[model samples]
Target: MPDLSHPAAHRPGHGDPDWAAMRRILVVRPDNVGDVLMTGPVFRALRAAAPRAALDLLASPAGAAAASLLPQVDGVVTASVSWQQLDLVPGSDPDAELVGDLAARGYDAAIVLTSFSQSPWPAAEVARRAGVPVRVGLSKEFGGGLLTHWVPSPPDEEHQVDRMLGLLAAVGVPSRGIALEVRVPDDAATPLAVVGERYAVVAPGASCPSRRWPAERFAAVVRALAGDGLTVVVSGTERESDLVHAVAGDVGVPLAGGLGLADLASLLAGAEVVVANNSGGVHLADAVGAPVVELFAGTETVDQYRPRTTRAEVLTRPVSCAPCRQLVCPFGQECLAISPDEVVAAARRLRAVHV
Candidate 1:
């Protein structure tokens, strides 16, 4: 139960002369959907700090999809380079063209948000090439030479959401009491009729294999919930049909590949609860105000990225090597081997609390 508020423990002085003159601002957060969703509070904070200033975002395709649902953003610019792919080709300069494109817009200032391990150099380089007047980011990689303002990276154990907000505070933005948000378009509300009301959503797929609880475990949870006379619907992208089908093999209705992001949001909005892995769906469920039961398999710290809502229940098994944060588990994934009955019990507890 770590505190997510008060991101900046050591507030820096706003002594920069140009801080007041900056008008148009750009935020670069080319990460995953969850990462982008977590930044919504920061985006809203930026809008509140500069009510009249135009704010733009540079994100990846997935990040852009999530950003489009945020109300504070004036526009989202899709970055051609993926962070994972960029790491593969360290010196390719694929972002060079994007820098030129952003330069043409003539942003007055920019802030780049990144984790402790990731250097903000790429975004800093783009800001420099774009000729943005004031560039702000966390001080790492000894690359402060490229930034106009620098904030120290938060301690390693700090929640990532707080860490991003720490960078925002470095540039005179307030970072307290903000909540995550997402906008579901009116048109996106149509397909949710298929789920009906009083249903639960089961998101059985995760981007990382180590993060996925066993498909059979999901099936058991679904079966138990269905047996309790609740309507259960499973949802995932088209690519995850196989995994979703495997999870729904023995219980409930298989709604796999049945909804897009917006449709999924609409459906989730109507659900009593959402049972999912520590994946994008966890954030989506939180966005729509659905109580979520998020299963964390020790791939990452539960406190760092757990859904930022009181309605959510995070379950993790304490293994000796838990929270290794590895892409692939060297040994069998014991962290996620908790019995299906245990997950169902947790889900039931969450449901009772919400009730």
Candidate 2:
């Protein structure tokens, strides 16, 4: 097996910092929505470390939406342009342009988070060019030369939220245990009134098809929960409305596309329980401190990636071909065939414990 722990060249480490004196900081987490959401603790830890520092975030558009609801992030910048779009284009100075734009913000330091498979060097290079003085990240590529401090990536495949907290720890920021937190704006708070006192949110879609439980199975879970007298609010993006509609038609209330990210957070925040696949919504619910019933299809390891919260209950079926990480299942999806009754049972058990 290849050594996956080394950082790529040009990546920097968490340098020696005067925690009290660091005033302006930038966090680069231009990944998926869930990845951005998981970085919430890092933002909080940074704030706890330097209570007066202004924190800004660099993320993709969707990630930016999630970041906007985080109280710890004072400002957000979207890096929507993909690496291929800019890097493959001949004579395009997109990297330089991005660096200049970030440099204009005048951040004193930055922290870049990367998984074993992802190289932090590219983002580190951008931060360096942006003139950020103290850059911090894992040292996988002998890139310690570029960083002021280099911390080893944790060997355990912990939850992404914990992984980000580890990065904060490297920079002298204390972790707030391992939990997700999001702020809901005033306007988003209104939708919660419609959900009433007791309701369950059903998120029926995942970014990858292989991770999604079958739509009908989700419908069954919804119907069962609804039959127990809990209102089931179906949630998904506008693109996922059709699937939400199909599930809602068979099971619960159709609130598809009616909630923005902030509204979704508000709704999840007030819910008694959230039923979702191993998707962003699960992480969002965890962030809001809502109890979650997570259905896993085995493409991703639930042990490693499941939300880090005591309120979360995960259900997975063991299969030899699990963790294949396939986008589309070629064979019949044996991984998702865990009986709907089993899911319902898990929900009932959770509800029982909470009651």
Candidate 3:
């Protein structure tokens, strides 16, 4: 077989750093909401290792929303980069301006975080251009002198949270704990009070097509939950109003497009059980300690991004085409062919445990 190792152009020996001595540090995870949420433990570890150093995050527009909830993050710099191909949030800074902004912050060190499939070189380039002396990232590809420390990417099955923690370990910063976390603002409020105090949230939307189950199936689950004497609410972004409405129907309340990240966390925190696809909402719910029933899709392995929350259940079927990592499925989405009954059962089990 051809060498699968996309070795870096130059593999320098690890440049050990005394994290505590650093004055300011930047952690880069310019991905989506879910990706940033999974980096929670990495932030906690860095905070512990360099408690006196100011810790900031470089995030995409969506990622920035999740970053705000991370108590360990001191500041957030939002950017939509060309390499990531993320659509710019209106009024957000362009990637071209990133170097200048980062340079102004005078970060002592920068750590670029990416998933197994994503290369960290692009973000590392920005850090390098900004004159950050100690830049660290993981890469199996040619580095092109972008990173000062290039840690090897971990196995595909390693959980995202663990993979991030492992990167910190390579840089001599040990993890504080492997748990997802977010802080709901004390004053944050949700519209769910109208739906009654006891309610389940059914978030039927995912960032991509393949990861989402059919809306009608979600509606069936909503109806079943309502029959169980629990109020049901459907949640989503404003763009997903129609889907949320469809899933909620007459049996459930539709609370789409109204809440911000903090308010959404409040909504999730108050839920008896949250049912969602493999998306950011699930990660958000996990962070807020909500019971979750994850209707997982086969686009990625369950173990790779599984919820670390205690009262959670993942519902997915084995399919040969799983782990394809396709944004849109060309074949049957059999992996997410979970029945509504199965989802209802899992939700009920989580609710029972919570009680």
Best by TM-score: 3
* Candidates, ranked, lDDT: 3, 2, 1
lDDT of model 1 at position 212: 87
Tens digits of per-residue lDDT, candidate 2, 1-355, equal 5656645432354345876688898888887778888887788788888887899998887678888877789988887644524346676666776788888989888888766556666777788878888888765556544555566676646666767777777667888766678888887743545556778888999988888888888899889999998888888888898999888875577776757898888888877788899888988888888888898887866766787754778888888897787999887888777888988888888787665
Top lDDT hit: 3
What is the C-alpha local distance difference test score of candidate 3?
A: 0.87
Task: Report the lDDT tens digits of candidate 1 across residue range 1-355.
Answer: 5654333423455344244455788888888888888888887888777777788888887778788777788888897664447255666777777878888888988888886677777678778877987778875346645676766667766777788887777667778554677888888853445555567889988888888888888998888888876788878778888887887775666776756677777888777778999898898888888889888888777777877754887888888996687888888888887787877887788788766
C-alpha displacement of 284 in model 3, angstroms? 0.7
Q: Which parts of model 3 are misplaced by more than 4 Å?
A: 1-14, 86-94
List the candidates' TM-scores in order. 0.90, 0.90, 0.93
Residue 279, model 1: Cα distance from true site in angstroms: 0.6
Q: Compose the digit string of candidate 3's lDDT tens values, residues 1-355.
A: 4555456622556567889899899999888899988888988998889989999998888889898899898999988776877565678545658899999999999998887888888788888889999998877778667888787777768888888888889889988898899877888878755878899999999988999999999999999999999899899999999999999999999988878989989999989999999999999999999999999999888998888865789999998887888989998798887899999989988999886
Per-residue error at 23 for model 2, in Å?
2.1
Task: List candidate 1 segments past 4 Å from native.
Answer: 1-21, 86-92, 190-193
